[model samples]
Target: MYHYTAIQWIFFFYFYCFFGWCFESTYVSLKSRKLVNRGFCRGPFLPLYGSGAIMMLVVSMPFQDNLVLVYIAGCIGATVLEYVTGVTMEALFKVRYWDYSKNKFNFQGHICLGSSLAWGGLTILMTEFIHKPIEHLVLSIPDSILTPVTLVLTALIGADFALSFKAALDLRDVLE
Candidate 1:
């Protein structure tokens, strides 16, 4: 059994989210032939699947002893997250990048292989491995540094998303 402090967990969440975003970006770029933002424009918001997986695993922290159950639970969480991202993005953006409405093995939407892999891998790592051991490693840091680091990282991600969105819109404008 492993244990981590509050700060470590926050750092882990940050790391997982960043890694998940990059992994999702690469996957979408390879599978959909577009970057993360482009994929968001051309396909469903699959990155949320990984983020959702992380959320699920975090929520289930108390029950990390069961690997199989954790993975299954994470998958369910990922599915719901996928749908939420899809619905929310549609409502917000007024367009859907991909349609899984008619596809087999899909529940009113598509969950691509890349997203699945990201979710599954994250589910395993977060639940079975990193949860407890890393807390000690991060807890030594001052609160001031931690707070600002998280804020800066979050802002950077937001900025990246905005830039990507602009580029995607520009491409759409050119195509039209």
Candidate 2:
């Protein structure tokens, strides 16, 4: 059976969250110019890394041996989540949060294959390779100490997301 330590699972959660934020920022930096010209606005919300990770976990539950499949699933799932979040946010805010659905690789308002692949690859690389090892390293610590630290880190991540969301709201002035 595929078993993971508590630390391992925690790392996966943080790792995916970090990747989501990174992907959103990276996409904005590299693609925003083009996206803007095309009439789409890059919303400030973090990309759906958590949702992707959750989806990946569920998919991987049934197929533990196939890492490749898991990675692929994570990438695709994350991309879809990101798109859905964007669409929902736009509807809630009455703004063009983003509009990749019309782009060449976009289908019905989501990113194209190119963007999706890039985000997915990065997420896999970070979560499977980088994050896993780091998690293991942290796990080697005594649990009594590690548990509290992990909780602190998770709280910090949540706070950071809140701040970023506020910043995104501020950016609305520019987008409008």
Candidate 3:
């Protein structure tokens, strides 16, 4: 198993959240032919991706040596996370942030075979390639600096999440 301090894990999560936001925002903006701030939050972060990355790392620990097992674990783990998050968000907000209702082999418009397969591939790529350099960079940082930065980020993200949650609720009321 990989050993990481709590701060290190938090940093990894935040980093992945930012990265996911960059990717999603760019893709969405390109698709829509306009700039789009994509995510549940107004900030440059996506908690789902952070959570998914962490889950991928944790679930692939035992199967790290085997590519096939790693892929399988990622498929199952990420799919479950996506499904749960989608269901919970829709239930609480009365809106779906994403839907796969038209996709083949979809379940309840929340999860689908294509996404599960993509998650498996992404897990393999992240574990095998993307995370090594990131891990090194994070490890190289001094704890004194990293700790304070993490604390600040935590506060900012907390505030952003609160505001976003309120906005989502307000939108739900409007829709109702």
Candidate lDDT scores, in order, read 0.61, 0.61, 0.96
1-176, model 2: which lDDT tens digit per residue?
33667665775566566556666667766776543211122322233555566555655555456667656766677677777777777754456656776567676665677777775566556556655565566557787876777788767766766665566566665676
Instruction: Assess the local accuracy of residue 95 in candidate 2 as a C-alpha lDDT between 0 and 100.
Output: 66
Model 2: what TM-score?
Answer: 0.58
CA lDDT for candidate 2: 0.61
Residue by residue across 99-168, what tens digits does model 3's lDDT show? 9999999999999999999999999999999999999999999999999999999999999999999999
Pairs in clash, predicted candidate 2: 101-109, 105-112
Candidate 1: give the clashing pairs: 2-132, 3-132
After superposition, the stretches of candidate 2 with alpha carbons farther than 4 Å from their true spots are 5-8, 19-47, 50-58, 94-102, 117-128, 160-176
TM-score per prediction, in order, is 0.60, 0.58, 0.98
**Backbone clashes in model 3:** 0
Q: In model 2, what is the error at residue 174, expressed in angstroms?
A: 9.9
Model 1 per-residue lDDT tens digits across residues 1-176: 33555654555666655555567678768998766443442232334433664576565665577776666666666766777877776665556766776655565565654555556666777666664354554576677888778677556656666776777666656655
Better of 1 and 2 by TM-score: 1
